[model samples]
Target: MWERQDFVLLLDLDAFAPKDRVDAFHLALNDTSVPNDVVHESPEKGIRARFETWRVGSLDLFDVRSTGFEVRRTARHVRRHRERPVVSVSLQTMGVHRAENAGERYVLGPDDIAIFHELTPRLYGWSGEAASWAVTIDMEDLGVPVDTVTRASVRLRTSPVHDLVLAHLRTLRRDPGGLEKDPGAAALGTATTDLVRALLTSAAHDAEDRRVRAVMNDSLTQRIMAYTRCHLTDPELSPDRIAHAHAISRRRLYAVLGRAGIRLEQWVISERLEAACRLLTSPRHAGLPVSAVAARCGFTSPSHFTRRFRAAYGVTPREWRRHRIQESSRTPPDGPPDTIPPTA
Candidate 1:
């Protein structure tokens, strides 16, 4: 099973005695990753390894830096440790790595990426000091057939989607701590899954397959949602501009989002209202006037913004900000303030 950890688990072999470091590192792997046999290449020289992992929504993001070692997952291991199938994509950031799966073998260098499945027997290892960033996703969540994933695994470099997905993973690794605390972390995980599905669809030879086409359509919808979120502050973020930016017809965009139950205008307005609410209550934006806040949140007119904000939140923006200020004044630094009784 994929371990769900909200905090990072770091294991540095230097903290253990030379004789016990290898064993400790081995045990750490079993706890954080799949069950497998770990063998250090030169235990006599002492093992230098560091493993860190944390969860991002349903995805497991990990980083490993170690001296020469080999990890073997045999048929026996798979049978004994029966768990949900997962696919792992790893990007080699340093040194060389080798992977073998189902009789196909590949050697990867810096910036190269490889994909492997947990349900299959495999061998993965590297010599000297090597580092990599990887993410594991459940097969059910990936929404792609096992055959499709396997077919695309070896040919990922052939498609531009490969670099796009790689860049996303790099960004996740760049600031994992910040990402873990982000409210949109779950959305980011979903976006990663969608990008992987797109990469698989593009790399696989069976692009004409029915299921592949469905995955592609779903990926487009996700892309639209992500793009909209990023451009929420732009006043020109309309259906025509969004559709044109994605190179899809306005009708096609509507069809995709409509099937997903998203009304473009309503969703956009709600998002803007929420943005305005956040800015109005923030101390950093306290000096700004309500009209300025509305304008900054993509509202062309302060009157329209007030109407929508009041309709959605049951109070005017100024009242909401004043209430927040009052609440802060009543709150003590050491403890939470007593709950205010509801007014009749």
Candidate 2:
């Protein structure tokens, strides 16, 4: 009854398990953990557990990393621990347990799940020493609609669809095979994302009224912005340039960002100024003229930059630069608009 054929482990199974498949999935269940004993049993009856911590490039559209724990019933108690940048969703496939965390208690059973934001500083425990499976996903990794996080946490429900979704995700986790690059990976990634989103929405019914489409659009825009910033050193970088990079017309790009307030041009300049502010305080650029730092963000004229950066932050470029050099962290987050470089 090897539930996980990934690691080699002792599996005591009756005739029911697929002979060759059980042995393979059985071996896959061997796991290393923090003194937690995981076992492999019949594909359906015994405890079969697998887990691993995952980290990937965060700059991608799917900025997600995961830590997963899949286990059959066992007697050992799991100590509560906090995971930053993640929300822990515990699903009780076939066992029952009480989950304790952050002064809140929850009981989970078959066809049930619990949602606990591990991002909160807290502790947690599994009740009844019940064996279960849980997945720790950096909410960002799951490309969760940040705008809807408050709504989704209202409650947790179980969805059979998760069985299919989780299985596909696990397959992707192990397969390097996929689209050639971006467009390809992005397409499959999007599909994988839809299934997960559907399951999440189903569990947290509040999403029924949520703006799932708008959130996806906003997130896609963010992906475009991140891409633009990364390629800023390129002399051709501009609103049109970025739109082209994302395979959209310049007008369409602006339309996409109509919801965020301010035009695309303003957003890019704001981002550049923010980046420049941090560099303005750095030692490498401290001795250089303030104009040089402005140039780095695509400014050509010192006079124009000073007025904008100052307008944004209330201090002239040189004044802001000096303030930053002395105590950068104290520099107000809003760089004086007076110091912002003029529009290109």
Candidate 3:
């Protein structure tokens, strides 16, 4: 629901009263996904910080031009985390900036793109007034592993594909309203996602045959797993059915799964079990019967579901649900939940 809503936020320190500028800037940055502390270095020049953000489709397009300031994410901050995972692609358009992550440092200049994982402890700063345009990629929408995305980030480099992505971003920024109003906005958005995925994939590739095959297989596995997840309730979700849907031979599909050290049937069963567990633990489905839960997760019979559930989890379905309820009651309201629902 939030994704469908279109909004924009623009903040300029110069527009605010001298007394309110610092507070306003701090509040504004706090509202963003990449929250950070802002410090004014030169008291005489004041701080020249301006930020504009547009939420278009799955991407958060950010245009930031700030005076010399430092943004730091400390280990303490990581412990009290509030933000979800996001990959920031910084396109340096003006002055240079330095980024430090895991003891590695990178200096980026104009036309150079650097990627950073927001959840990773890092520090970035620039001297004088540095200008840059950043595109924030939602971790969930990247269709790849967070580790893979992180590996492709925070590097100082230039490429033809990077130039193309920058061009598309410039067009999107110039006429955001027009693009949003167009009928092909969704398609264009998808194109941008694919472009970003391609950029990352290309950057992380190697010349070795084994490495290339591994990369291709990993991407294929992610796509197949995503498809299976969406169609988990389908009773006919067999390896043959998946192969047909993806236009790949069944043998090839088996080989792909084999490379990932998983069997097709095992993957499907695990996804179904995860879905059933999720429904059983959810308050919304509290009144749903065990048979209903089993049927919803593609099980043909309640007894079969119970047997498999107990075998995999070392507990019966009812016992598992009771345990989850008790645990939830004792845990803090804002505490993190267990990593269930199984992502591939």
Candidate 4:
């Protein structure tokens, strides 16, 4: 029914007669940004199909619950529709399913995740009350190498990060409100995208050369940055601890960070100092002591925080706060004109 609309769709084939199921399902699949041909072996009793889908930024979430059937995305369909290159991730929640693309077949059982290219010729088949939560991400916005993505689609074995991605996706599917709005939604989308990229890159590491490993290293760097950003307040946020948390050696972690021009120790200190600076400058935090801000930002010693803060910003924390407050007071009611800070 919503063939032309590009937003959200909730389709239930059970509401339609058997003769109309094909058309209804076709439109629903198209509405969810996947156009395919659905085939059934025989006319049977109670052919049920339901899809609940919504868009979260550039990503689309689809929850499908249906009976036994096969869906095909053929070369002809690809030519006629001219779909964009997208990465499709399926989190199988119930039963088993098979996906074939680029002459490779992958079987995904319960609690499994499979990756595929949306524009490629593919086939999907499942029996019984098969169901899954699927998400399609735009390839261009993925910020990872396209070749690795193509290789990863062939087959991806599950890992800790892969399982985390599945659990997070289940949360997203259950309550999408956290990803449908602004501000927080952007972070949510970015987190999900990074997790997916990390999962794919890690899975693609087998039989890879140095070039491909470099791409995978970039993904690892991103995941490490995300992990560090969230744990900056921890007193034990050292290279050893971070490396252990990610199951990578200290040497490998250093190599990965070096490739990105990031020194692990310096980066962590920089992040902590940045957080402390924000707190010092925030009006709401004006009453907070410098030592409190330092401790809150992971510095064990106030003296060390003061020395490092002065070295990085050319002023002590208290001096910087005083100067910022003076500058704010001198500005007119309209507020200081927008100025871009110089990048270090």
- Which candidate comes out best when scored by TM-score? 1
lDDT of 2 by residue, 1-344 (tens): 00111222223223234455444333433222122232322334332222333222221111111122233322232333223344445444444554444345555665554454533322233422234344445566665554333334434335324455544443343322122122445445444444555556555453334554444343555546445656554545788777876578988888777864547667666766765675565554568677787788776677776777887889886777676445544446653222222111
Residue-wise C-alpha lDDT for candidate 3, range 117-219, written one tens digit per residue: 6667787878888887777777666665655555666432322245555555554554454455556566556656666665566555543445434444445
How accurate locally is residue 69 in candidate 4, as Cα lDDT from 0 to 100?
A: 75
Q: Please write out the lDDT profile of model 4 over residues 1-344, one tens digit for every residue.
A: 01011325488886898988877877877666556887764446657788877677777778788887788988777666434567878778788988787688778787677777665678887877788888888887776566677676665563335655666666566445324643556666766787787777766675355644664455577667767776788987888888997789999999988987889899899989977876777666779999999999999999999999999999999998888777766767654421212111
Every model: Cα RMSD to truth: 8.1, 18.4, 15.3, 11.1
Candidates 1 and 2, the one with greater TM-score: 1
Against the true structure, what is each candidate's TM-score? 0.66, 0.38, 0.54, 0.60
> Whose lDDT is greatest here?
1
Model 1 ranges off by over 4 Å: 1-7, 224-247, 250-344
Error of 4 at 171 (Å): 4.3
Instruction: Please list the C-alpha lDDT of all candidates, in the order they appear.
Output: 0.78, 0.46, 0.68, 0.72
Better of 1 and 3 by TM-score: 1
C-alpha lDDT of residue 52 in model 1:
83
Ranking by lDDT: 1, 4, 3, 2
**Cα lDDT of model 1 by residue, 164-244, tens digit:** 566667656655654676687898888889888888877886668776567666688776775676677788889999999
Q: Answer with 1 or 4, whichever has the higher TM-score.
A: 1
* Ranking of predictions according to TM-score: 1, 4, 3, 2
Is 1 or 3 the stronger prediction by lDDT?
A: 1
* Between candidates 2 and 3, the lDDT winner: 3
